[model samples]
Target: MTRPRLLPVPLAPLPNELIGSYLNRLADANRLPIRRIDALIATGRHHSRDKDDLTGWTLSSIERLAALTGRNSPALIHALPSLAALAQPNPLPTPPASLTPTAWKTKVCQLCAASRGVHGLAVQRTYPHQRICLQHQRWLGGRQLPISPRFHELIRANIRHRRLLRGHRDPLQPSALHDEARTMTSRWFSNNNGPLELQRTWDDRLQMLNPDTESDPHDDRNLIEMVTYPETVVLTTLLSKPHNPVHHDFLAEVIRSFGLDPRSLPALHRHTTLPSSMRNPDTPSHPSRHRPGSKSTA
Candidate 1:
């Protein structure tokens, strides 16, 4: 006896969607339990605990899914970023030891998903640089914020961050730079005695994002990160360049551009270090070579 061909469903997978999510959507569309659909498509033991799990999936399983969905394997691969890794003979490359994965995994923007006929929740394996949906102007991985002019700066910063990521050969370099920038920005934001102008700017942003009388903006780390993103991008760019003494005027100008007093430079200098590539090679032994805060002594 031979197995029969499965009927194709009308629903299609969204970009970067998990294979499990697509299967669930298919089951929902056809009014069948996901287990039935899984039994039909997945030859290996299915794990239901983690929705993102593709542990036992082979190339044949992906091909089965593609056939069941009336789509080609390439189409499925294009839609599911992790499918290629699963289909390949080799395991996925391990991320750099220095880089830790974020605890948060973002869902596809509700509006973006609905636009593609995907009404069910669809989780995505997003990169560190991917925080906002530029097309829909929605923040991912957290409660959605209302569209406002205040978020425009964040959107612009994200654009620059993406561009930076593209130009770098080692993604870890950009990731490290972003991490450092986030640390500086977060620290400065938490400093009550920091520049009053900068503090007021962030406070206004907090109010804009959280208008409810009882909502404490300080409690929402996502909101704080979003509001501080512009400065972070700017600082990342500054730190990537060589620490030129002649750049102090330019640095102060950039600080002033953020509505911060140039004298507040120490707040940015406090804990930040210059990247090795950005350090002065002639004065390798100089204390300021490692720490940007010691520039005055240099």
Candidate 2:
């Protein structure tokens, strides 16, 4: 049997009129975490500067909420602001406590229909303010999608058409974060380089082949890539083998980048003419050698 059709619940930033119309909805399906909702308002104020819609919404929602509760929503919200309201201590609370980075990510993804993706989840510094995820960053049509493009655009455009045009003019609020991320994405950054790390994997394979002394690091990488090497062809063959189940997708790319066969890692692991203490640490160290900046061999 087919599964029952689930109705799509409309996301919020719902207007005042619709909110009143859906007042019973909030009362019945009070799935809204009041603390979280309040925290969201506080976050808006912190990030949006003078342009805070949620605070206005909160002021109104609280008023209406309080009238329903036979108390005051504004007073209650003010008297006991959510953790997001407390600006100094913690940037943002993680799962169960407030909002998990994952939950925030999933929430943004859902809101945007995941056109790109929700970034900023990985950016630890700006807990509340971070880039869109790799998924949401819109590179194609040439628009840096803002956090609340749909939500804020409607408001900003209505408020000032000259300022907020649709994906037309300048970036909504220019941010320097991506510049920093791009500048940082080079060489042996743990996240960037896979082959450099293959030092261990290559060593393991060579050890299994001969079970001999630790192969020179340079020699090892070289052997792995060497045209003269049989093992060099082995992994490549695994990908092309008709009988093999998995494709060597990455291996193909590696071969192309490193060439059909490359230098042996033996030279890589070889010690320099000068002692370790004198070497420039910024330079990549060979196996059994320390990078220069570290506690020198002195």
Q: Pick the candidate with the highest TM-score.
A: 1
- Residue 235 shift from truth in candidate 2, angstroms: 17
Q: Show how many residue pairs clash in every candidate, following the order shown.
A: 0, 24
Q: In candidate 1, what are the lDDT values of residues 22-135, reduced to their tens digit?
A: 777777788978787777776566534226666777777777777677788888888887777776677757775434334335787888988877777777767657778888
Worst 10 residues of 1 by lDDT: 283-292
The C-alpha RMSD of each candidate to the native structure, in angstroms, is: 4.9, 21.8
State the lDDT of candidate 2 residue by residue for 1-298, as single tens digits.
1211212332222211122223323222346533433343332322211122233354444444444444444444443223124322445443231112211111223334333232221111111122233344321111233223323322322222222222323222111211221222211122323344344454454454334576552344223321112222222222222331122223334345454333433332242122122224453324234432346666
Computed on alpha carbons, the lDDT of every model, listed in order, comes to 0.68, 0.29
What are the models' TM-scores? 0.75, 0.20
